[model samples]
Target: MYSRISTVALLARALSDQAESYDYLLAGAGTAGLVIACRLSENPKVSVLVIESGPDVRNDGVVTSGNFSFTGANDRVLSYRAGKAVGGRSIVNGMVYIRGEQAQFDAFEKLGDSEWNWDSLFSYGKKGERFEGPDTAQKTAGVTANPADHGTNGSLTTWKSIGVNPVTDINGGNPHGFVSAPQTLDRDKIRRSSSAAAYYKPVDSRPNLKVIQGNMKRIIWANEKKNRAVASGFYAKEEKLGVKVKSAMPGVGENMQDHNAMVIGYGTANTLVGDTPFATLVTAQDALGNKMPVLAASSRSQISTWAQAASTYTGGAIDAKTYEKRFQIQHDLIFKQNVTIAELFPTNLGSAIVSQLWTTHPFSWSSVHLKSLVSFDDPVIDPNIFSLQFDIDMLVAVARKEQKAYSTPPLSTFVAPNQVLPTNATDEQWTAYVQANAGNTLHVVDTCAMLPLDLGGIVDSKLKVYGTSNMRVVDASVIPVELTGHTTGPLYAVAEKAADIINNDS
Candidate 1:
């Protein structure tokens, strides 16, 4: 008891005397957080401190085993499906390395931030990667990669997957056709390489970097008037604390988006006897490894898409001109360039793998709102799934497309006659099926979007939150637009660019 008391007292005194401030103080030491923290502290003259929401959880099963042997997302590792660790989503997420469609980033530039486009971000994508091509034996097993499209050396490592054969180079500004994608994996270590493993650990010994665990209550703002709102520091309630500040922007938690699946199951003739059934599943080993999914992959190949002026089909009341300008880019990308818009995945069903078709760009939107700012409490997340008619119409088109492709000659032979969701069903039936079966890809993004302040945006081009100078949100939440496949690749690019922007600013 005496020893414990002494330790507590020492810790209190240490914190009270701790330098009182840092050059940079980040709230969450997650995926993007860690990346920025590492980059800023690189300057020996600067000091950085990170306050992580969860404990370090360095070697915990949730962080290490999720890649190799850990099977369930809601199983033993961590009960909740979200990343509740120091490394954030990178630790818990399946590390598939696929970037966003070129058009999506270009659309970001269209939304008034000319600095944020595919060309600039493409370089950062390569900057954060250390890709290793497949070996001769591995190539024979179906793994493939274009050496030019990948970075030879960087913080994160990616390599070929034996899941599918290649049709084209996916990372080279366009990802429309068939391609064997890469994963953020440490081939030498034979484990899933998370952001923590890739970007944080090597620089852990840096004297300028300090990491802590605590909840960020709010950004402490200066009461005095200024041109832009300036935050003096951040506040956290470790014990008894209280503070209230009303949010200035209504766009803070709105505009969240996620991918939805339109599945058509079947009972296929189990050929190869006991051969493991494979399909394009999102992340499963089975979200990439061995399970059913939210995101998908292939032994299967997915697609490209186009959108028309269909504002009447929208779910929420958004700006009409804003909606048209955005959809115009989607249409242009389809006719002018090669960009993946939807995906086709195969899922395991005890004895067979079902084909699932979903739109990469869904019109539906949702929010994750905070009810209180004074306490450390979980926010309410409202996922308005398939609330938009445009998404369902696209899924219907996708189902019809799936039916047409499979019912043809060579691909038709593999598709069994035991209709689970009946591909021959009418448009009405398809709509009903879409409404009843629509599910998440777990590819949620843009809650704290990176758009100009004039367009209902939460953050500016530099990734600094609007209305506040020092408070910035760097995470999957800051992605202005959602990508087509696994969201990890584009997220890294965002962090890398943010680091450069921060470095340039300071």
Candidate 2:
């Protein structure tokens, strides 16, 4: 073992000695990369190297503050935020940890990814989490839990929000009603518990694992046959540090998706105050109740229409039948399985409840493409938000329902006599407002989707890139479908499962 003082130098010498190849080369030292590296490095026989674009931010106060800000790509159209440090977005995101609806995972299984499902992923979810059950104060506040769904021995720590009742286990495949879920935080320290803190920090002394800071230029394909390209390695450049490195990985960067969100702030007269901004959340069906069936039926046809458009957009990369099958799975999750169509974050803002709304699934697809093969340029990102009319319509309906909720009973009594954001705004106006003000939740996934190659999938169920050897994508990019919950929980589960898969394969 190398001492703390000599570790960096030793790591540099090791990298210099083994510059040509590594047992495993990870493109980004973010959430997925860190988890995989730590897990793989457990075996002293394997050599692991992780290349990150950002600096070592393990002790940076600003990055570890648990507060969020939009970085990377911020524009009028889309304000995209992605953490550039070792922990990635986990360091900056709202720490709400939800396992997502069972139906959403089932949809992934139905997409011909047999290995993916609720039960299987749920086990992985537990594998990566260490649940900090409710304390005395929290228990009195109504926070209950199912011990079976929680893990006692895991890397990440989860804690219940104070003064909130845990109606049901959100991980028990049903999160319909109001429930107090866990957050990825160090309750004792009151600080963010990111993947880097939980996974990387523990194993930083491992001699086999080496993490280098540099921006990935592109995947160097050994064979570029358009359809049968094989990955050899990647080129990276860090100008500030005057460092450049080339490492191997064919499936470096591909398939990208993000959660699109819009906030509907409502001013009220109630003096609601709480340290936690939002501790309670309700699914769309729970919020809409009996009036959901009609709207669900009306939206069914749009699935096929979207599939057709998606197929055309891909230039037949995915067949019409495949596209329809993929979209139909999503349709079932939303309508039949009752997956969350929209999420509402009711923040008690002194004199208002800024009801943030987020659409669970959007038909739009975007990409992160390299501008050139040789240059270390930033990847061109196009988050085609509101490309589909259905997304806009769904958001509009969510806004309308939120308005209705504000006007009802106990909630209405707290509201100010006057309405904010025009309570009686027409459908046209709401739609226009959503279009102009909506932004992404930074929960991006599915760029290098894990589906069969015939269905436009970049990676397989095992996360291996389809036409290559020794290249895998174990990040949010492999998620085939958009999920109802935040990306952190699912991604932790994915990385845990990915480690097992890789170990088993080896």
User: What C-alpha lDDT values do all the predictions have?
Assistant: 0.61, 0.68
Steric clashes per prediction: 20, 7
RMSD of each: 9.3, 6.7
Residue-by-residue lDDT tens digits, candidate 1, 1-506: 00000011111223453224567777788888888888888899887878776877767754675342112111112122567677888787756677867777887888777688998988888987889887675565455577788789810011123332234456776665445557677766656677788788889899988887766655555653355665666545454545444346656677777877655665555542321212221211211223112222211112112112222323333455555555555444433343556666444454554666666766566677766653346676666666545567656665665565455544455556546456567778767766766676677787777877655577888777765665677788878777776778888888899888888876
Report the Cα lDDT for residue 241, model 2.
Answer: 34
Lowest lDDT 10-residue stretch of candidate 2: 1-10
Candidate 2 lDDT (Cα, 0 to 1): 0.68
Cα-based TM-score, every candidate = 0.78, 0.83
TM-score of 2: 0.83
